[model samples]
Target: MGVTLLTGASTGIGRSLARRLAARGEAMALVARRGELLDSLVIEIEQAGGQALALPCDVTDRDALARALASAEAELGPVTRLVANAGGGEPTFVDGFDSAAFEAVIQLNLIGVANSVAAVLPGMLARGDGHLVATGSLAGRRGLPSAAAYSAAKGGLANLMDSLRIDLRGRGVAVTLLMPGFVRKHEPKPGRGKTGRRRSKPFRVDLEYATARMEKAILARRRQLVFPLSLAVAIGLTRLLPFGLDARLLAGRGRRRPAAAQPPRTRL
Candidate 1:
């Protein structure tokens, strides 16, 4: 079987997807900035009777990514699937401006993804057998106030996947845009854990459920997969709302809850 290379393989959805794919007997090349984490994941998968090659390379470094791909091919095989999953950005408002943070966000969230795509796609096209899967967000469908950079990057990613699908349609390579909404990775929701681990509160859509949906879509080469029927509906409504109202409605969801209002205490 050809290798499946996944970026951001250290944690969250990327890690989960890697585990699932490996369990299904898919050989994998795991990529992430965290060397130790990638090593651990590879060991776990191998111990479970799977094959994996851990590659610790910063996606933002284009040459590093290319080298990593070469390494994977040498060890595992040609990558038949590319998962562009790593991304991060600092939340910024127009008032509290930080140019450095803004640029860093754009570089990591946008250029990093593009670099990964460039690295593996040529080989896939030449072989005429591979798939490109990317993670996009509901925020990409509309502008979210404090998350301008985040939305912009994901939106670009979704569009890029679409264009790539068209550009390589005849080559037998396909692209899948995995669009998700509000994934709560920091905390687990109640009832999510079987071993009594603290589960995060359920966000717009549960990650596990969404990942399964994504897997089927990828296998079928679906152009796009957006989750949470209601959320998609809400986004549809956004297009119809007047700017003043829509933006305001979208603004409140991302607001930081003020630190618990402290009561004034008087000591006797």
Candidate 2:
């Protein structure tokens, strides 16, 4: 199998997913801005008799990302799978809105994925075989009060994947979009909380559980996958509500929680 190039591979979903794929004997091209973490992950994978190459890169930088992809292909063979999972966002409040901050989130979450696809899409099209997967969020489906920027960026990504899937339908390339809600930053230890509950959000799930579902969807080449089912349903229902009602319903949800206050809902 050709190498699977995964961005944001130093932590959270990308990190865990890399290990899961490696266990299946697939070679990996792990990309992230944290060089040390990537190196350590590489060592861990190697120790397990798995193949992995750490390519530290900022997905938002087009030229740098291209170089990283080239290096990955040179070292581990063609990358048959591209998981554009690197992204970040900060709370945007109407009271103190910052255009520059909004742009930064857009660049990282939307343009970054575009850059990644630009680097590998040509090769995938030429080979007529490949998979492109992106980790979006259910937040993208609705505009949360303090997370407008985050919601906008992920919303754009979801639409981008939709268009790509339609465009690549007749070709051999496949596209999959993952929309997850309230995924925990770490795995919950047994007896850590009441019934080992790590988060209070409804249907909140841990990293390992979330990544397992993502892995299955990618392997199955599903067009779109949303979880947990309860949260997905809630978000989906919001879309059917009147604009005014929907806005009022989520008005008190994300009021004071700055985006920086929590780990990125997506990945790096």
Candidate 3:
């Protein structure tokens, strides 16, 4: 396998995917803002006999991201696979719209992905062999009740990947978009509190399963991969619903919890 560079490698899905890829002995360049986490991950991968380099940088900064990509290429070889996975967003309520917050999300989710692609596309085009993959969300299929900014960002990312795929067709660079439903970081602890109680996450899939499926899609160079199959079907069917009824059914369901007040954590 060729060198693979992934953003948002510090935590969550990004971290899980890195582990899976590392286990397969792929040369890796892991990028994220959290230096400590990335360092620890590098140690873990190296200890496990995988080759990896940790490059800590914020994806929102195009210059920094470019530098990170350069460092990765210098250390691990040209990045043959680029995963634009750095993204996060909190609730955006229409009643209290925060332009700055919305802009931040767009920068991170949409523009960040573009930056990653721009940093590596020229080299990939020159070599005529590479893969570009991104982590989109099931929420991108439609506008959500309280996550307007997030939904818009993810939707734009999906469209961006689609366009890239079309433009790069038959050029030897493949693109894949992963649209996943709820995926938990870990199992909830029992009897801690109401908050600790396992809330029902729609069609939630474990991290391992999600990463495994994503790996298969990447390897197959699939255009789009949505999961779990049940949620994908549900989201597709929602498109047939009348707007007014759909709004009513989804209203109040996505209310932002006050405790979610912490600025969105920057991760994949």
Instruction: Provide backbone clash counts, one per model.
Output: 6, 0, 0
TM-score of each: 0.87, 0.91, 0.93
Consecutive 10-residue window with the lowest summed lDDT within model 1: 259-268
Model 3: residues with Cα > 4 Å off, grouped in runs: 191-199, 257-268
**Stronger candidate by lDDT (2 vs 3):** 2
lDDT of 2: 0.87
Model 1, residue 174: C-alpha shift (Å): 0.2
Q: By TM-score, how accurate is candidate 3? A: 0.93
Over the stretch 115-160, how does candidate 1's per-residue lDDT look in tens digits?
A: 9889998998888888888888777887776677777777777788
What is the lDDT of every predicted structure here?
0.78, 0.87, 0.85
List the candidate numbers ranked by lDDT, top first.
2, 3, 1
* Candidate closest to the true structure, highest TM-score: 3
Query: For residues 1-268, could you state the per-residue lDDT of candidate 2 as single tens digits?
Result: 6689999999888899999989878899999999999999999999999999999999989999999999999999898999998876777778768899899999988999999999999999999999999999888887776888889999999999999999999899999999988778855578753475333456778888999999999889899999888988888887788857888887776646445645323221
* Per-residue alpha-carbon lDDT of candidate 3 for residues 24-139, written as tens digits (9 for 90 to 100): 87888999999999999999999999999999998889999899988998888999999888887877867668999899889989999999999999999999999999999988
What's the C-alpha lDDT at position 266 in model 1? 10
Backbone clashes in candidate 3 total 0
